[model samples]
Target: MSVHRSALCRGPYGGEGAAAGGTGCSDPAIFEVARHGRPPLPVCPVHLGPALLMASGVLWPPEIRLIGRVTGLRP
Candidate 1:
């Protein structure tokens, strides 16, 4: 699958313990994550951990899977 590196990380951020204001991470995306039949989301390494944790809580059996890697992208 073709992956876009231009998209910024879509992982939610800026909560009680995180820096406030921003709703998601600003880092460039490194992986394209697919959530079952839902549209894929771009996520960076920095937020991947938190994203997974959040997903595990929301979905009974987390359906999030790595579908593609953004070429030439690094954390």
Candidate 2:
């Protein structure tokens, strides 16, 4: 069995692990983790979370936060 980040890393803009030490899909912390290693994350700098960073009292480059959600279909 294998676990891909695409699965583990997909969710709303605040998903946990999204940032290095974040607590949601869109956590800036997850970006830090994705910055390295195989299957590099294709995160757009422009879509980075500025509001989140500000609320968290963290700083980052100028950009917009592109938010989305990953959901499973049920039959």
Estimate candidate 2's RMSD in Å: 9.5
TM-score of model 2 vs. true structure: 0.18
Off by over 4 Å in 2: 1-12, 17-42, 49-75
Highest lDDT against the true fold, candidate: 1
Highest TM-score scorer: 1
- CA deviation > 4 Å runs, candidate 1: 1-3, 13-22, 56-75
Encode model 2's per-residue lDDT on 1-75: one tens digit a residue. 122333333212323353532224442222321221222232323324443343332223422323333234375
Candidate 1 backbone collisions, by pair:
none
Question: RMSD of each candidate?
Answer: 6.1, 9.5
lDDT of each: 0.53, 0.30
Clashes of each: 0, 16
